[model samples]
Target chain A: MCQLLALSCAEPTDVSFSLTGFAARGGLTDHHVDGWGVAFYEDRACRVFVDEKPAYRSPVAEFLKSYPIKSRNVVAHIRKATQGGARVENCHPFMRELRGQQWVFAHNGDLQPLGDANEPEHGPYAPVGTTDSEAAFCFIMNRLYAHFAAQAEMHADVDDIDAVFEIIEQATRTLNPYGIFNFVLSNGTAQFAYCSTRLSYVIRHWPFSSARLVDGDLSVDFAERGTPADRTAVIATTPLTDEVWTACEPGDLLMFRSGALLRRAHVPVPDAVLATSKYALSELSAVPA
Target chain B: MCQLLALSCAEPTDVSFSLTGFAARGGLTDHHVDGWGVAFYEDRACRVFVDEKPAYRSPVAEFLKSYPIKSRNVVAHIRKATQGGARVENCHPFMRELRGQQWVFAHNGDLQPLGDANEPEHGPYAPVGTTDSEAAFCFIMNRLYAHFAAQAEMHADVDDIDAVFEIIEQATRTLNPYGIFNFVLSNGTAQFAYCSTRLSYVIRHWPFSSARLVDGDLSVDFAERGTPADRTAVIATTPLTDEVWTACEPGDLLMFRSGALLRRAHVPVPDAVLATSKYALSELSAVPA
Candidate 1:
């Protein structure tokens, strides 16, 4: 239905050729064209681009083919909307800030029981558009403010990253009432990913090899620019083709940092919301199409 | 500074177990707590949840560990703010609307060139916050509207996916003068990713093996649920530990759909901007904080 791409490496590396091929799948070579976006990380920074237009026709896509914005971390998406509008604000690859760092995310499906727009004026972080994704983000930030307040009182350094992940994972389940809940998230130094219904991954380390793009007639030899110490990981909804991929198990959420898997596990499932869509009126429908 | 996790597969799969460990890395067992979000995709729909709270102490994160939201595609993030204040408005994985779809996005790192609150409506999309990332998103949307207007006479299926990518890619390069621009984006069906610095990937299919997380002591035997017919890919800033990873080349732009790479290339860097930060500053400074 949609496509997702990401990179995690021990050392900084560029993903020009592979991404070009992947972007085309949105509407160029394939027909997933609803919207598209891409993000790259340098040190503790991120560069992102998004458009409601098709990738192939956009001059930005053409420019990407020639410019190589190298990075050790990256995330990208091409969309085909089913629930919301087809505008740029509804595009994927949303970003925010927390604890003095930037965070990035993208999604490839629909969500139900999205809470009402409880956009709290909680300081700096705020939504620029309307979407369940933004609402959820705002909700999280509001809760975080409360938590930080608590932390300040406790004088506890919430640096045990695992503790943070646990909090986020748990909060997400509470926000939604129906359907699937899978996602990819990251900061500059580390990254985290989870699979609910569909997800895949591939990693390239010491013995680099040549890889050809399945969509476009392009290939890259990792053996040339990459070194033995350079370790990397790529994740997506489906295999990027031309490369091997690994599937995530049901109820599995994973984390990554410095080009390696930081942790993983099988967790419990959230309560399912009863299906009322069949009877819900158009105005009351989950998606006001 | 932050952590990211994602899942892309051919069918529905739970992400709790894997996420449990990864969640812990963000201030639980490790320390990436600024905020977090996750989304699960089923066919053409998605279930998303986001929390500005640390993944560690939030009851929401705990609930997620117990709940199993499944989907085919997913994206998640844990933040350490690098731009806006640690408020809900500045959270990563911002969302909005365009045309007729819901789009999601998240980012890692920082940038300048933000939206001008005083001016308000730039074109189509508008920023609710001061982050450069949001402004860039609005700019892209405005451009799309303008381009579509210019091509209104032709009214071609103009869904040329590449065209969209080309435009966004160029916008990204132009926005680069502010700061790092790394991020992830999605809109229901496909996902697109790009790198300026820090990005990598790892993919697995058919013979999916076991993978361990680096941030925590957890692992998943993907072979348990995977079938030979299934193919998937995972992309992230760093490998989730057990998998191999590949890096994106400098200035490279990419596209992805249905879990496959379709088009790819390095975006051309303009010599004028390359000559000095003055251009970047000028363009970025135009944006209101």
Candidate 2:
């Protein structure tokens, strides 16, 4: 398993104080000695650094800690591959450009039962390494491009905001059948998240308090954050379990803009097998609120 | 930007069918081949495969594609190191065990200012690699053990559902100050997910239609497998763009059990800054919903 870290604040702030303990797990204490990467947003642009080295051992990871680059939105990941090859190309926190905006993404799961490659209308981007994660990313971007292009033919305002949301919603569901798809993606403007099988979230608001990492000795006081109006949210495969976390039900999709929930869509649960032997456990399963 | 895939079904199903196209992107069709791995959940146990070669070139990845392993829960990942060393150890979808159950995690971001490593109090479980991801995993287990022990001291009900949830929640938030912490975690029975900056999700039901991968040309028809009684959910970094995906707010943590939402908690957000600085862009800022 891998680890992911991110921060979205009312104002850009350095992640130093918080990252201290988290970084130690990479190599100094943890087994994800694989490569790691981080990305921070700066005025509609992202400043990112990726390396095929553990965050603890990598001089670059250290430089980042000291450099203290600040951003309102940040995405990060440490790799533990389950598919493909291990190389720089497979490093996470991958970046892509869409409509002149840089989009960042990282993943922590694998899709088995791989299918044959389909030719992109454009020439193949070609894999640098052999990780299925990167390939999936490319496929997503390529499909998004195609979807946007297809939509552009009918709608001039691709960012009509409403259309973008509707379109994105449709796209996400289409990919669900492929396999477990757990990812974090960001455009300089906002961060989008989804939950399928194994995901959890916590929305931290004004009433902040001191929190410490169970993984390391680092701690942070929300009181030090200056403004109590700041709203920060953290999401993960498993609830970090250090604070109160909420679990999303299957088929629920949510949207976030500026560290707040904007919209949500709940995929309907089919009733075909409510009382059948196939879903007997599910029928008896009562979600603990 | 990287790709993530997972499979959590009522029964075991091979992921290689879907993995083929995903793997091609790294070396064949795309470029994410740093390393590759896949896991199959058989009852409570998971059978996994990891290779350092490009999936397109690796005989192992090929073998898995044709293999039909099945399980109720599975997690997989590919690598694209952004930080840390790119050795065999630094792969995605790391696995561990605690309290007699196997736990797996994968990440797609980087952590800066990594703190000192803190091994789980349970034992000498240490990271083999240097990525912050693994360190985080060990930390979680340690915290769980500590929580359980603390409960034992109070003579609390070890089986108390609320107790388990509370401990997990606290552990998650504790990791935040470190950096962007987004991940997918599973204990073979339940899955946990979170979003720190960017993530999204989508869920599917019985009427599994033929789906075409946006990244590749292959298509799968779910109608052939079973009736419309099946239901599943998916979470990812970005909405798949071609499917119906939901976005998670910056700091929303959620939990999932048996493919359903179990609970939720919102972390506190910081205060909002008055727009005194000229840096504020009136056109881009949108009020959160």
Highest-scoring model, lDDT: 1
Candidate 2: C-alpha lDDT = 0.58
TM-score per candidate, chains pooled: 0.48, 0.45
Off by over 4 Å in 2: A27-29, A113-118, A122-128, A153-158, A239-241, A266-289, B1-289
Q: What is the C-alpha RMSD, rounded to one decimal, of candidate 1?
A: 22.7
* lDDT on C-alpha atoms for all candidate structures: 0.61, 0.58
Maximum-DockQ candidate:
1
Q: How would you encode candidate 2's per-residue C-alpha lDDT over B1-289 as one tens digit per residue?
A: 2345554554444455456655765456445567766655555444445555666787666655655555566666666565655555566676653433456777644455346545322322445466787677666766765565455546654245456566666766677666555677776766667666555666655666665565566677766884554555556554432556677776676666544566667653222211211222222122112
Q: After superposition, how far is residue A205 of candidate 1 from its true place, in Å?
A: 0.4
Model 2 iRMS (Å) reads 21.8
Residue A124's lDDT within candidate 2 is 19
Clashes of each: 310, 216
Residue-wise C-alpha lDDT for candidate 2, range A1-289, written one tens digit per residue: 4666655565676667556755665666556667877777765446556666787887667656656766678778777666644455467777654443556777655554335442222211223345666556555655555655555546544345445556556656655555555566776556666554444677667777777665566667876774766777665544443677777665566656556667777643334322232332322122222
